[model samples]
Target: MSDHAPESGPRRRLRLRTLLLALPLAGLLLSLLLVLPLRWLAPVTSAFMIAVRLDDEAGRWPEYRWVPYEAISAQLALAVLAGEDQRFAEHHGFDTVEIERALSAADQGSKLRGASTISQQVAKNLFLWSGRSYVRKALEAWFTLLIEACWSKRRILEMHLNLAQYGPRTFGAEAAAQRFFGKPAWDLDAGEAARLAAVLPNPRLYRVEAPNATVRTRERHIRTQMRNLGGTGFLDRLSE
Candidate 1:
């Protein structure tokens, strides 16, 4: 009986170790097979469905459409770059300057500006559940590094454009273009592009056509930024 007890305890310990090792392996496998493919998954467009699940009441997930790095409108890309990440093409996964600035602002009790890069946003939107916790942030960083290491800058931007939240039941530039202007993505002009970029900060609060006074102000500012950045030419350089 004493010998059996010793053997049973050792076996239980070994089983626990095996289970712990298997857990991460399973997660890796699931990521490769399931989460990675989300880049190509059709956008979920049912407002009722999304409202039932997510806390955000105004954003919609659009069908997945992969716009080639070249086919995407340069003006639209430029607007996004100027509005979202001015140093997108140059930075790696993380932007330290922006991070430091945001941290300082947070400490000062000002607006809590997030320093999440497009890649980080992509990682969170595509793979992670939304939360404002240190654990979630660490995971976001890990996935952002993995994505940057595995994918090109162009690919990351392309994915972000296609998967990002636009409006309630609207996702992607193409979907938004069609919904807002009854036009294809390629047809969006600089003004239209700027409006889209403006709403990106908070799409639910801003309408494309009849935007509130604040949204109108933001759109105007984005347009001014776009002009200062040399418009489409800046986006052309992103590929370089």
Candidate 2:
């Protein structure tokens, strides 16, 4: 009996080691799969679009559109960078400073805000489901690292521009532009672009035509940020 117990303990320890080793290996394999040119697989963006539709039908809500990267107005990109993640181009995956700031703010009884960089957003959109949980956040971090390791900044930005929710049922800049003004995204003027970017923080509540006073206020703030960033020039940098 003593001999059998010792043998089983070694076996159990070995099993635990193997399982621990396999976990990251599996994750690596999955990450590789995500980055590979698997055109047949349903893209993360498309899946989210479907989810949005289902939510709307079920009386839950999601705002989204499918705008191409090229079709989107430059100001839209700039405004988002200015408002959401100024260090987007520079950061690899995470923004520790912003994370600390957000944590401190939350601790002070302020609104709990996200410190997700553009790369993080792209990863979340492409791979993970939307929710605020420790597990979800951990997965988001893992996927963000994978995406940054696998995809270029240009590709990440492209995916984000196309899939980000702009309004109720408006998923991308092109879709939002068409839905709101009957204009294509590329033709949107500076003010129009700024207004569209303003609603991104909470598109469901912010309408283009009859935006609440708060929306109007946010638009003005975004425009100011855009101007400070040199407007169109900052947007042009996204391409380079």
Candidate 3:
């Protein structure tokens, strides 16, 4: 008869250490690899836009244009930052204060609002799919850290402005500006930019050209936030 014995302390500890080290090492490699490509690669499209197109052929294909960061009106960028992420310039990748508030709110049975920062949104839009899966969120966090580490904050903001969905078939500031205001993105004024930012929360439900009462309210809120964030000064430190 053969007898089997459970592994003892030293061997078990060694195995544990290997596993602990392996996870972080693997994460480091993934981040480093992604960082290098992102430094020079301006992605023409994103996973979210592709996903939306695949499921719905009811509308025209989304309009998308890649404009340099400078080509976009600073107001539009500021509106989006104000509307979606006020702490965008301050936070590295995650916003723990908002995260904690969301958690506390959830625990209290309050309405759940997403606390995804702009960087996290960019990570999700560029590299991952939409939805509220913990698995997807974990991957998003990994990619967010990589993006924050590898790219300038301006690059992150610019990429986000060009990729986030503005309507059912509208992608990017340029497309949304043209579609809604009949002007290029660079020409977007404060009200136009605020309206666009208003639709960002739920583009399908809000129309920029014909905003509903709710959307109008949101637009007002975004405009107020934009002023609070100090207009164009928000991007001061976001350069290379």
Q: What C-alpha RMSD separates each model from the true structure?
A: 4.0, 4.0, 4.2
Clashing pairs in 3: none
lDDT of 2 by residue, 160-188 (tens): 77777777777777777788889887888
Q: What lDDT does candidate 3 reach at residue 80?
A: 89
Locate the minimum summed-lDDT window of 10 residues in model 1: 43-52
Which regions of candidate 2 deviate over 4 angstroms? Answer: 1-12, 36-44, 58-68
For candidate 2, which ten residues in a row score worst on lDDT?
36-45
- In model 1, which residue pairs have backbone atoms overlapping below 3 Å? 43-62, 43-63, 43-64, 60-169
- Give the best candidate by lDDT: 3
> In model 3, which range of ten residues has the least summed lDDT?
53-62
lDDT of 1 by residue, 1-240 (tens): 465435587888999999999999986776566445544554343232344246545444334344554665777887888888888888888999999999899899989888888888887776676669998898778778777766667777877777676676577888778888888788888888888878877776777777888877877888888889876777655542
TM-score of 1: 0.80
Would you estimate the TM-scores of all the predictions? 0.80, 0.82, 0.85
Best of the two (1, 2) by TM-score: 2
Cα error of candidate 2 at position 236, Å: 4.6
> Candidate 3: lDDT of 113?
83
Cα-based lDDT at residue 98, candidate 2: 96
